[model samples]
Target chain A: MAAAWHVRGLVLALLLAAVEGRAEPPEEESPWFVPDHAALQLAGSIGLLSAGPGWGFLRDGVDAELLLGWAPPAVAGEDFLTVTLKGQWHPFRPAWRGWTLRPLTVGLLLSYTFGDAYFVGLPDRYPDGYYWFKTALRPALLLGAGAGRPVPALGLRLQGYAELVATDYRLLHFLQSPATAGTGLFSLALGVRVRF
Target chain B: MDGPLRFAVLGDIQLFLDDGADAVEDLRRRDVDFVVQLGDLTEYGSAQEYAWVAELFDRLPVPSFAVLGNHDVLGTGADIYRRTFGPPFLSFQHAGSRFVLFDSNSREYAFPGNVPDLEALGEALAPEPGVDHRFTFSHVPPWNGDFDAALTGPLEQLQAERGVSASFHAHLHQFESEVRRGVPYFVADSLEHRNYLVVAVDGPVVRVERVFY
Candidate 1:
């Protein structure tokens, strides 16, 4: 299972790199004060999806934004709210006329979850005394990198992002049971971002 | 040579410390792609317990993957799991299916959104253009107080939206099957019962049989 995640991580990294490599110098300079714009997004994979809005400020074609997202849970069966702070350097300034790395952005995120512990599918050996589902506090640190290119012809902004989750798993799971301990939970994600 | 893959899912092999040898021997007689240990393979997540479980898994003929359980995280025990197994939450593909293994054991400590790490699960579950089945493995389920309930509904919905074939979890020790938001959640039996879930898949078709050994 570990090997497969590595392969997928590599694919995502390469794709992000390729997209960033398409950047080009800006065609025209916009007033720094205009503060580019903002967008709403919906993203998901497997049985998880998150949607929310972000506000972006543009200066010399560089954009920085803060995002707030929430997921209702799908496969894992939970819900959470996440806040992300990000900065983007779009060298291509919205469009790439030729070969340029376009817009490359990197940022950090933090999230929190609410509700009781349902502890979905544990085996029979784990007794009721062993675990708890309602974790009041949970936080994660994510280092992310992303790139985008605008395809006016297709009426979309094509972008991709890769994020690494850094956090402790046991604390997050908060297993009150004797059966759980030690393990930390973290993740990496690469996905395309489309603006309609 | 193309056939279904067979493997075992063992949950919380704790306290039984001395009873493990028999389970190891039983596994030797089976043909499997690999074995997946659901977590709590140790009593205290101690190096000593980990070493014992490592030896047991080593006895298997096929490779094995494991998720880090809460019990495996106390003191230096968590460090032991990383050194002995690999990552806590992980994802992989075998026999044409995608297996997303992640850590859901929350509350031994706390993070802003660290426990469930929904983003990570989302990434692991994201559609693989060509893969026929998507399966999720974790030590704790959303219902457990140790898990974040807020993330459960979203996770179930995502699995349904993403077309996940099934979700696997251990920590409860009993065997069960339920549909949450239209997704099948299978909880395997513990080693004490000498039973495990054996999953076989061919494209979109999957067969899960309870095996004792």
Candidate 2:
């Protein structure tokens, strides 16, 4: 239990560091490793809330993020911890009424959970091909839109986004029951990203 | 304020959640007093799946109960099960009939020998003046290979000694029943097969029937 809290502490510290950094760094002072943005999200399959550091490239059109997620027992019926890597592409960004809108954003994320019961490969107790999918790692496809505007005082761009996440497990079950899978085919995640 | 005690027992849900939904609808229309799902609620035992299944169960017009199956022990699945359905070995009485639910997926724990915990089950099945009938439910049957082979005879003997009216199980995914030492053992059919078991007890007699949906 102490180990779990220690890991959680480390992740929290990392996210806090990203959030507390300078609003603006001169081109010469900023290194490639410095994150371009920081994000906080809620209600993704990975966790009830997730926070991360994100890198923006290709004229801020493409993004890569590393997130730490946690779901408390109060909401999720059980405690959950996950680390997610996400990649996204925004093909079009339109400015309307001082708000920049990402008309289309396509993304994918792979998340890994921490626990002894979850295994990436079959355990020795089971024979070959006992189970196909890994419970420890989950990959999801994301589709949605976002809009943001410059915050002059903070020297940052604040963006709000919504994503429809279709996890691998949900997709697998979808084949068996489209009617039941119905709206459950996708879970909604909402978040805010702050870019320096 | 009485009639025959009516309850429905469903088999492994696993990937057949749609079928599970349909079964709940059928049970509602049939007017059962309560319902029980034998186990294997999810294939991978993901929290999303557990949450989805909880929603499906809540749709039932009657109270519901569930047992832990082999698949439900994957990852932190067992803990999730406890959080969702309470401790695995549960005993309760409704309408003078006793119901006992326990974990029989010994193989999931690598045959820990006490997976079924016969001593606890014996206590749960102990007769009381008010309790008119006894029924026990678990995932793997005592005779199945997945069950703790060493504990089979003892389990069967215990159930027989207790005069259990019926012992129900699911995991073979098919419906089968036979008399073991004069007591009935019924294996429920999984939702994939489009059928479920309904048990009705009248006074001293218990009747179980398969209803195809």
The candidate scoring highest on lDDT is 2
**Maximum-DockQ candidate:** 2
Per residue, candidate 2 scores C-alpha lDDT tens digits across B52-115 of 8899999988899999988898877888899899999999998888899999998888787888
Q: Provide the lowest-lDDT 10-residue window in model 2 chain A.
A: A20-29
Please give me the DockQ of candidate 2 compared with the native complex.
0.45
- The residue-by-residue lDDT of candidate 1 on B81-195, one tens digit each, is 8888887878888767788888887655542356667788888878776678888888887666667667767767878888888888888878888888778888877777777
Across residues A1-196, which tens digit of lDDT does each residue of candidate 2 receive?
6377447647665765755465345454467567888889998788899987888888779988888888897765556778899998999998899999998899999998775667787777667776787878999999989999999998789999999999998987888878777878888999999987
Candidate 1 segments exceeding 4 Å error? A1-196
Pairs that collide in candidate 2 are: none
Worst 10 residues of 2 chain B by lDDT: B43-52
- TM-score, one value per model: 0.52, 0.88
RMSD (Cα, Å) for all candidates, in order, is 19.3, 3.1
